[model samples]
Target: MLRTPAAMQDAERHTAHNYHPLPVVISSAEGAWVTDVDGRRYLDCLAGYSALNFGHRHPTLIATAHAQLDRLTLTSRAFVHDQFADFCRELAALCGKDLVLPMNTGAEAVETGVKVARKWGYQVKGVPAGQANIVVAEGNFHGRTTTIVSFSTDSDARADFGPYTPGFRIVPYGDLAALAEAIDEHTVAVLLEPIQGEQGVVVPPEGYLPGVRRLCTESNVLFIADEIQSGLGRTGATFACEQEGVVPDMYLLGKALGGGIVPVSAVAADADVLGVLKPGQHGSTFGGNPLACAVATEVVRLLATGEFQHRSAELGERLHAGLRALIGKGLVAVRGRGLWAGLDIDPALMSGRVACERLMERGVLAKDTHGSTIRLAPPLVITAEEVDHAVAQLAAVLAD
Candidate 1:
């Protein structure tokens, strides 16, 4: 651990103290595993917060990125790049939407969705000018943008970040009646994550998503599903919404869409919704550039095969089952779908942070959220044996 201390200090010395990171200093990684500066390997259960659904340094994604790098990388939105068309078309088709607006980050996609929804409210829904309001859920995590955080319920993310933006109504997540009460004629949209990842992978009540879809349809309000952390085969299906057989008016997608190779996010909707933007009204200079398009297009191709989605589903059953068996043995609860899970440890025994540290010592890496919950999202490329190994390590940590 001699080299690790200096590297950790160097990491914190120049960077802002925005994150409380694990104490390992990783220097290289492959599928399902990473090697630290001291050459200690750990099974990666966090999977870059579900961004690396395909795993670290996935061969196909790296190859595509390399090929694109040799040809071209960036171009302004003022002009079209060669790889733009296929990327947009395939992604739109995958989402079953007619139009797409690509952006560089998940937050930008959310901001774009907010703008588009409001514009559509003015132009299409005929809400009074400057009166379009949005309904958001409590314990939701869309992004860290000022506008997004204005409606957030987390004190750490929301506090001291004001003067906050306005025109949003917050309601308890999974309360169909509360959500219904929040929407009205002035409401332009309902923004939510189908599965609240940061809120300990909290899945809403049964039929809640369908209820929200019905409510939005009945009120003519756009339903914006932020699938950044839950989409692209993370939750067994292509989307978490599909598990409930619900489709929103808009899909804010990112994370695995870029194959964890680049920062790429997008807003997908039909022409009537996304087309509300005129030429100069909304654009990103680095959005849909050659490199992003090329790499993301291949990413689309990978998802098109449906292999990852199926793998996640089959393996997810095993993962959840394994975690459930440990419920009374230090684990109090386990919640999630597919390969994603939030395991709640017995608080009397240890904090989630301490559990993670112990797991690191046992050669597994995962992240904790809330006070007692740790989220486990191993890469889809991980084998059944790897999953067992990760579970075994967690069991050992708890046993100690």
Candidate 2:
């Protein structure tokens, strides 16, 4: 008897019923593929929602982790560690920012951004205390924190999460007029994903981000780009905003910063913007620990080479072309950039979940979101052949 069902059952029995995972038990992964306990091979197309952008157990990242593990691990936030400063400096340079405040998870980075923006508003922007408001777009997915869920448009994420925190104004995404009208003197920041990944890899209209930048500057409001999903070479550019020549006042990065070995996230900004916080304002126990810093430093080194970004740009064209060709066959629409794509299956035929189940049987692993939409965010390291294999698998599933 195979241990797959027993393992899956044990996982489902013990874990909270929050996630309805597909019926697959992966044992190990390398590069862009995973193997199950049954020795079955499957290409990993989801890449942990872009967290595994460098793929599983990348040699450089793993080596860095091992070396750091042998040296030191955690020192809390009370004492400084050897690996801290270099990681901050190098990552700040990569982001072209003056300062970097490290955190452990993407949600923590977002919370840090929110706190910083609110403080900057009162101390710098001259907004009254407790009156700061941050404008967010509709259909945005920042994180699952209570404050984040308070502003979410999704009923599933927001339904029972109240009494919700106030001070967020929702505006239509890709609509400049609504965004402009939503901004007021009390507005301290405009938080958005450069490309809404959870919103089905939705890209805003051209010039929309530039318009947001100009509007923020004109209104004396901070532009906070939540690049946790769209940054670090997932979008063909270092940052998705870079493709449009728009820079946010603060960049919220995570997912790939730890090189898929450990959790790492950060907020990068100029001193004038990120300088509002004093000691003891906000922190995490494991945030900026020696180990996270060590692994993330290597991740920064990888991005600094621009190899992954170039690969994304070159192979993205091929990936998108393949996906687009599936239109009218089984896909109703395809939207994304680089190796990331959100495919809308024909609802009249099958739901996204069923399509994913069928694909799972064919040795391809992906994730489905919303009702009929499935997202494909393969690792940046995936080869052109792997890309084609994934597309071919989807085409076959659609045909079936």
Candidate 3:
């Protein structure tokens, strides 16, 4: 027996069952590939669910992280660290927003967005106190926080975790009519993912995002785009909304914002919407710490250059073309934008889990979202040949 089985057993024995990861034990990773302890290499198609958009241990990100580690690391929210202002200012400028509130995770950013929206509704929009509600889309995967999950339509995420928080209304995704009907006088914000990553990378129909933007504008409600998984150059743009020519009231960002080095998330919005918060209202301890800010500032600068965005756009077309060619063979459908794609393997052949297991055996690492749907979000730094290699592995797996 190889060393992997024993390592896998040890991992399962010690950790919680929150994630059902593949059996491969990754020892190290660089760019678009990872190495197992047993010396096997695998193409990384998941890219840490878009968190590794810059690829594993990107040189610039790594250098900044290393330098920050040698200096100060944390100072909490009480005293502002040296790295905080640059990160907040640069990230805010990137989003075309006036203010940015840093947080530790995507879920915290969502929660912060919710709180900010409610506060803005009461303070700015003049909604009735305690009657503030937010509109959300079905099949959304914001995060697993109690408040965030309160609006979730997924039973797996919402069930057993509730006695849920109130003040959220669920509407069908990609349906402007349903969304318009769901919003009321008390509705403060409309929160949605431009592309639903966890829900099989579902893309809304054309004009859906712009329509949502229009409705939110007309209704005087905030349009908060949860771009945690779709932003930071994953969708051929700094944000997926940019593809639709829509600028939301707030941008909830995470994942790639930390350059896959540290946990960093933020809610960016204009002064009018984000300024509703006073000092004591909301904060995070390690949110804009020196280490996180050092890495993420470089992340913002990289994004500002628009290099990754262009790469994702060009590479995404090639990826989608390759995937669409396989639709009639083993894939039922392929959906996504930029470097992100969700492929539905024919269920008659195998489930997404089985297909992923087979792909792993063929030296590629991908993730399954739904029953027969697997998501492919390789790093933006991946090469054309690597893309072809990953697709070829999938083709071979399906053929077998």
Q: Every model's Cα RMSD, please? A: 0.8, 0.7, 0.8
Model 3 CA deviation exceeding 4 Å by range? none
- The digit string of per-residue lDDT tens for model 3 on 330-376 reads 99999999999999999999999999999999999999977999999
For residues 1-400, could you state the per-residue lDDT of candidate 2 as single tens digits? 8888898899988889999999889889999999999999999999999999999999999999999999999999899999999999999999999999999999999999999999999999999989999999999999999999999999998898799999999999999999999999999999999999998999999999999999999999999999999999998999999999998999999999988989999999999999988998988999999999999999999999999999988889999999999999999999999888999999998999999999999999999999999999899999999999999999999999
TM-score per prediction, in order, is: 0.99, 0.99, 0.99
Off by over 4 Å in 1: none
* Best lDDT among the predictions, by candidate number: 2
lDDT values for all models: 0.94, 0.94, 0.94
Candidate no. 3 TM-score? 0.99
When 1 and 2 are scored with lDDT, the better candidate is 2
